[model samples]
Target: MTVKKILGAAAGALGLMWVVRAAWGIPSAIGASMSAIQPYASGAVSYRDRHFHNTEPGSQIVAGSARSLLYSALTRRNAGHPRGVIPLQTPVVPTEAADLAVTWYGHASALIEVDGYRILADPVWSDRVSPSAIIGPTRMHPVPSPLSDLPPVDAVIISHDHYDHLDKATIRSLVAAQTAPFLVPIGIGAHLRHWGVPEHRIVELDWGGSVSLAALGRTREGTDLVLTCTEARHFSGRGLVRNTTLWASWSIVGATRRAYFGGDTGYTKAFAEAGTALGPFDLTLLPIGAYDERWADVHMNPEEAVRAHADLCVGDPGHGLLVPIHWATFNLAFHGWSEPVHRMVEAARAAGTAVAVPVPGQRVDPNGLSPRDSWWEDVG
Candidate 1:
């Protein structure tokens, strides 16, 4: 056998073994972010309890078929390449105020500033997003900012328990490095506790639920940073059992401005609902990556993301600058490395929506924004 093939087989075997262990013990690694349970915030849960999310649905990820593996292999997938970086002229940090800024570290990992508090969302700095160190979708590029370089954040929000979003080593590293509390959706806290995160450091919530974190940098004198768990149309699971816990997006309302963190999701009416109830957001961080025709309902395409922003507010869809995320950091799904952003930019233009597409690792203040050249066009 070829050396690469032998190594691939060995690595896959070991990874499968490790995944088996994680699945065997926990069965389903979805639940609250804290160590305890909390009632649903919107009075009732939005999703139905399904058996498919908890186990291998019909023996495959795509249900009754190996479509996930097949499509994943068919796509000319590549990791974050060095070809498409836009050089920094002045090297700006997006965090203008203590609040109202965002640094897209890669994929969905971002350090968001609002009102006067710093919140890290889905901070994955690890080399890979898989159960085994050797397998799964590895990061295409290095994390733009090292974990230590992260400023003192007030809270870290985890949207779900998927391995890509909810990495173990990354979580442990964040727990050791940042003295921030973990705000997660219902049942996700089980995995966090199992991974050794302290109980006091965990605050669990369900969809439409909100929690207030006070005294963070004290900008508005008497206000606290509020985090609200919002619904997303998607599925979750780390093992055989899926959706046993929960998946979500978050509404981070600071002292003055508010923003939405689009964790992995599909297209649903929830975005408009969230915007109506919790928006006209100052900024909306929505996903415009990893979408395919087969799963249109789960992930929003670039065009849909723009429409979502419009549905979120009363003014111009661009009233609140839209920053595109969930792409450019890692090679999760296949399409060209820059295709997601390129298409998104086109869609944004067609929709007459304003978008700030920053180079991975660069921060942007959607309010007082600067011009950014298209950097991803080179990757094919």
Candidate 2:
């Protein structure tokens, strides 16, 4: 072959390889930032052996076997996706914060309104919950509102560093669009910094730590809003490694009302402790999806979520409104698409827990919550 032909062929091969890599995900080790994580990670009491440990003894996040995983993936094909197009609603930003309101945007992303303050939790708006756009669990519905359209929030809380909970693209967009500080679990600031978020806007906290949002100014009734980092029985990581950063539930304490954001957790004794320490919450947002028997140690099923809510509400699951999150937007489990909500509603009814299953992007007021309507019944 001619020298020119050889050179052209080599160039073509390299270009094709680049396209393939982009279609797949960029390796987490190459794409994610790891610097400046040790100090923040080690500052937490739970940090040891270069990782953050869950308080639940003998609990382990089992990955199961590769053969089993593949079998489930192939055999449960029809069970993973919705039966029809999931209804999507346009999110409405209230003129003023309600006493305790929540706007669920699907799959663990929700906005909490308490004491005239707004807090956005686990705001993952990307199409896929992975490092790549072409792979991973894609969203079942479009984002209710664009990130640029999000109203000014007092704080953005990140529960963990998993790809589903923390998307690099969404973080970058939020950093550019919102002035609120990113309140994250320990070591998560490294990802924020790598995404070009300002250092001043990053607030890293360990379990039992608290931060007051006085910088956002007092509420209408002259009360300072506070957020406490609490315990969660879960693991965290975005790449091949695990538990490099802390995972947590958050307590948003307002003047007359409080809300509990249970990011993503399995059932644990810590929920009762959290209730004792930060109890009688006006509202509780808990995960009720993506759970399986194999990962029960790390993810709570619907019934466990109801029990967790009860534990967080001081033994009265009905004490506060329970609005289920972390479902309907993505297919990340082996159960049928609508199974989580069905199970959650059934369990809540049985336990007499006041539960509300809000459609994607619907804003709900806990004080005057409407009756449970199975909107997802027809969709999946």
Badly placed stretches (over 4 Å) of model 2 are 1-32, 58-66, 215-221, 369-371
Each prediction's TM-score against the native? Answer: 0.81, 0.92
Best by TM-score: 2
Candidate 2: TM-score? 0.92
Please give, for residues 1-380, the per-residue lDDT of candidate 1 as tens digits. Answer: 99999999999999998877645423222323321432232233543443213111212134534666576666555533436543322223534345588877778888888886788898787786666555567666677766777777779998887877888777888889888889987777777877789988888787788888863332345668778988877777676555556778999887679888888877667777888888888878888988766566677788888887776654457667788888766666656667777787888788788888776677887666534667666543
C-alpha lDDT values of all predictions: 0.71, 0.85
lDDT of 2 at 195: 73
Cα displacement (angstroms), candidate 1, residue 206, comes to: 1.0
